[model samples]
Target: MDRARLAGFLRARREALQPEDVGLPRGPRRRTGGLRREEVAALSGMSADYYSRIEQQRGPHPSEQMLAALARGLRLSLAERDHLFQLGGFPVPRHAVRADHVNPGMMRILDRLQDTPAQVVNHLGETLAQTAPAVALLGDETRHSGLARSAHYRWFTDPQARTPVPAEDHATRSRLMAAHLHAAYTRDGRGSRAAVIVDALLATSAEFAELWREHPVQSAYCPPKRLRHPEVGALELHCQVLVDPDQSQTLMVFTAAPGTESDEKLRLLAVIGAQRV
Candidate 1:
């Protein structure tokens, strides 16, 4: 890896971003205008010490995953993200088909929605990032790996995946999830990740297999959802989706009507703050 160049690039990018740029507050005691190493590390989902070592050019070679995390954390453009991978002695990511790398503009919007239940998901239903409130409401969808990374896969394979939604909604949710996967599979074609997930589910989930035969089509609209939170009881929320120009990623914001019980429950969720009671 080009240690010197990579360190320089990281430092420059970190310094260029202001607190407001990433939805962080500039406290009265703040000295420099740029974001601190800890702030960047927090946003990047890495330890401050680990990030510090990289800036000092004394750490081990960063892996591709690490570089991708840094790219997302810094809200780097596609060009800058590719440069970051190059400096780390890796190939430039094929972000066109690989939807893991969220757009910087979308990341900025997610950053601003810290208090709202907001998350960004790729076309294949892989969660790219989530706000704290989203975590509180949705239980950290980004934590899964492999086929389980796709909610469509998890919904049929893992029973607990559907815990948030009420029992009455399970069949409808299953159909929608299957239809969404079918859309992704059709778009990506065979040998794509979507197809891989489809193949896996076809082998394992009888429900998914049955749904696939019916050839369900996903609708353009995202309808209201009823969720049964363990701590907060029942909630009826509307999901607002903002699709990226590329149509590869979508930002989903969950909100309830004003002056309603669900809205009050959401307020209580803010206070609960991702902690399960």
Candidate 2:
């Protein structure tokens, strides 16, 4: 990753804020950019030395609370806040993941969901297991890809892939998912794999970078999604995500409730899958 560029970005962002931006008093004869290290530390409830180290990119990992404080003190935009967390080697604080691997029971659950689109996602949205329907939903025959590498990245970065969702919702979803991944990274101790994904996404999509600044939070729950398939026109699907009570795995299922047009379409999709098989 571009440590120097990240440091420079952090410094530049900090310098651009006025004292009033974070409720600090403007000191007389201030010649430097943004708030001083002491001022930021005071606002963020951290020591000046510690804040200095962060600015210098020499500090140890920061806690989620501390990062939140700094984000507020710096008046960082959402994207900027995400960037700060990335630089600090801390996962973005949102929906935290537990450090355990998937279990046999959860895998069995995925297998049982044969007709429904179901998959297992970690806190970072990595696909650990998937049913046949889930793989078909992603237009992939094999369930080997990570959710982080799937349409989440493409929806924001690729205009062609983004044609399905409304622009505003698309952007919101992107930010929310990134925030969820960030939270997972934080919970899992900010591993290199997470960092690499974040960096690659940022490099490829300015929209992702902009949304990342927003610092959104995502929980594993059911939500409705609007999708426009190339041949199917428009579809609204309800997404249900169940977190294993005993493990860190999240079981996600998508279904179209009975007696709806979406249900009919889903049935059609299933038939298509059967034909392909």
Candidate 3:
């Protein structure tokens, strides 16, 4: 969208980091804002001229290795690294939207993971398909609840959504989901439906808007989640997200580690979910 602003943001962030911030020694009488272009070039294994071109918006495509180096030199957070990649025209790593719809095999995979509270989500965290247990895990009563709705709408607008999960955990999950969605939108040329979803979420939730603007990117598959389920009380759940190599979908499964109270509680939830089904 704003290529110039993107480039400027990258340059500004690069210039904002001190030499010591990136493990470089502070030199004598430096007049520039942050680390010198030559210093960044040295850290990124590129010529100073080449790095200057990048900063000036005249450079050619940057390789993945170059981006990684720049990210390290800039001391970028996960979000910052992703924004750098997008600005450099590098392929953002994650799923992409396809012209074809979700495959039946993928749907079957979600069905089979019934016991494991699983759902099929697009790269944008939209729940394309989900199992009964997965819906229950998120405390959604309806059978057709979408991940986008669960995350953007209910999480922000509905008190019941926050009631089932601790405040801190809910915020973490929302940020993580937003980061993943941001990567998806960036990778898809910034004009896909996923990007629209991001814009809508940004418009609706100020928190989502702030995180999206930060441009965080994460491939967080299995993060721990704390749930205060209405029926089950407090429980900790581990989330596992599987990226479908052949398709632009992620299979997110929630499981409790073996021989723990969480595992027992998850089992109980599974039983209750089965009865409702």
Who wins the TM-score comparison? 1
Q: Against the true structure, what is each candidate's TM-score? A: 0.97, 0.55, 0.55
Candidate 1: which stretches are off by over 4 Å? none
RMSD of each: 1.2, 20.8, 18.5
Question: Which sequence of candidate numbers ranks them by TM-score, best first?
Answer: 1, 3, 2
Residue 123 C-alpha lDDT in model 2: 51
Better of 1 and 2 by lDDT: 1
Clashes of 3: 1
Displacement of residue 249 (Cα, Å) in model 2 is 2.0
For residues 1-277, write the lDDT of model 2, one tens digit per residue: 3456656775786788766555455778887757777886875568999878776767666676577667655655555667777775676545332222345456446645778888776554556555666655655422234533443555555576667676768666776667775665565564445566677788887777877777667665556988875545567899887777555667888888799998887777766663343
Better of 1 and 3 by TM-score: 1
The collision pairs in model 3 are 79-216
Model 3 stretches astray by more than 4 angstroms: 1-100, 139-159, 274-277
TM-score, predicted candidate 3 vs. hidden true structure: 0.55
Once fitted onto the true fold, the runs of candidate 2 whose alpha carbons sit more than 4 angstroms away are 1-102, 141-152, 155-163, 245-247, 274-277
TM-score of 1: 0.97
Give the count of colliding residue pairs in each prediction: 0, 7, 1
